[model samples]
Target: MRYVKWTFYTLIALTVFAFLHYVLPQHDIVRITNTDTRRIDFGENSIFWASPDAGTGAAQATRDVKFIETIQQNGRPMVYRNEDTGWIWPPYFKFNSYNLQTEASDLRSTSADPRWVVVTHYGWRNEFFTIFPNAVAVRLAEGPNERIIPWTNIVILTLLAVAGIMLRRMWRQFRERTLDPLFGTAEEVWEDAGDRAGAARRGARTSWGRFKAWLRSLGS
Candidate 1:
């Protein structure tokens, strides 16, 4: 049972980590290589995609998605899908895919005159699933190796930690005020019953001793 409890807690922690990693904005310093639009048919990997642009109404099973291609500082290739998250999950509220694509195209440069930009995005680039990270914003970087501090992530995680601590404290107070008293009362009742049973047994033994004394007197 102890091992099972630990395993359950480990799984829950991993799940929360994965969820935050996917939802939180991440920064990548890269040089824009190309910007293009591709028609994608929603399937098993559709969940990785974002909702339609604001005021675009419901999303269809098939649609065109804008993509920004880039080469990272380490020379590794990365692709980001430019789409509006609308009012859906992750709450980026981005509705400017066209503008972002235009900006990416303008920032395209060659190796000799590389225009490095920081791409703020979420999700993972999985080649196996052909899912690309959704780009939320893009801005010019000072250099290819610009130091980007994720202050947003730090603040959000801190708030979450505080919330968890508060919740645990509330639960402890509830147990002490509500549940603990009930259990304690039940224990007192059980102890009292035991004491009464013991006293009854003692009374019975004393009565038996007196009856035996009367029998001995008669025999004498």
Candidate 2:
């Protein structure tokens, strides 16, 4: 049971971490390589992609997904698929796929001029899974060596911490108000039962002593 409890806690922690990593916004300082739209046929990996265009059916397997191509500070190629999250899961509420694609196109620069742009995005760029980070916003960055502080992450973690604390307080209050009183009543019942048992034993002892005295008197 102890091992099972620990395994359960570990799995919960890992799941929370994965969820935050996927939902939280992250920054990538890179140079825009190009921007294009491709008709992507999402299959089993459809979950990685965002929702289909707003007010449109999500049944189609093939759609024209806009993409923002970039080269990172380390010279490694990174591709971001620009899509509107709409009013769906992850709740980005982003409906500016066309605008972002245009912005990415405008920000494109060669390796020599190197117009570094900060891509604010969420999700993961996994080659094996064929998933790209969904770019949320973009702006021109100073240089490849620019330092970007993750204020979004800080605020999100702080809010999560507050929520956890609030939940813990609620649990403690519930235990004190409900479980503690019930347990105390049970404890009192057990103590009262024990006292009754001890009194009965004493009563039986006194009766036995009286019988012994009567037998002694008859013998005398």
Candidate 3:
């Protein structure tokens, strides 16, 4: 049982970590190699993709998805799909897919004279299942070795910590205001009952002693 409880807690922690890692924004500095658009079919791998364009009821299983081709500073190639996440989960509020496509196209560079860019995006690029991260914003970087501080991550974690503290304080307040009073009343009632029982027992003992004394006098 103890092992099972620890295993359950570990799974829950891992799930939360995965969820935050997926939903949070991350920055990648890379050189734009090329750009393309192709039709993608979101079948069993649908959960890996974001929601349809904003204000649309439902999205079809297949659609034309934009691609931003780039190469990282480490000489590894990376591809990101430019898609409108709409006003949904993760809440980037991004609706400028066409503009972003134009920007990425303009920033395209070759291997010889690489034009570095900071791709502010959220999601994951998986090669096996064919999933690409969604780009939210792009900016010109000084060079391939530009350092970007993760303010987004810091702010998000701080907000989560504040929320957790507030929730714990609220729970404690509710117990003090609501449940504590009832428990206090129950304790008082139990103490009073104990006192009454003690008095009744003493009175019975005194009456029995008098009865014994009277029987002894009668025998004499």
Q: Which candidate is the best by TM-score?
A: 1
Give the Å error, residue 57, model 3: 8.7
Residue clash pairs of candidate 2: none
lDDT of 2 at 177: 100
- Give the alpha carbon lDDT tens digit for every residue of 63-85 in model 1: 88899999988889999999999
Against the true structure, candidate 2 reaches a TM-score of 0.83
Residue 190 in candidate 1, Cα distance off native in Å: 5.2
Count clashes in each candidate, considering only residues at least 3 apart in sequence or on different chains. 0, 0, 0
Model 2 stretches with alpha carbons more than 4 Å out: 55-57, 187-220
lDDT of 2 by residue, 176-199 (tens): 999999999999999999999999
Minimum summed lDDT over a 10-residue window in model 3 is located at 48-57
How close is each model in CA RMSD to the real structure?
3.5, 3.7, 4.7
Report the lDDT of model 1 for residue 67.
96
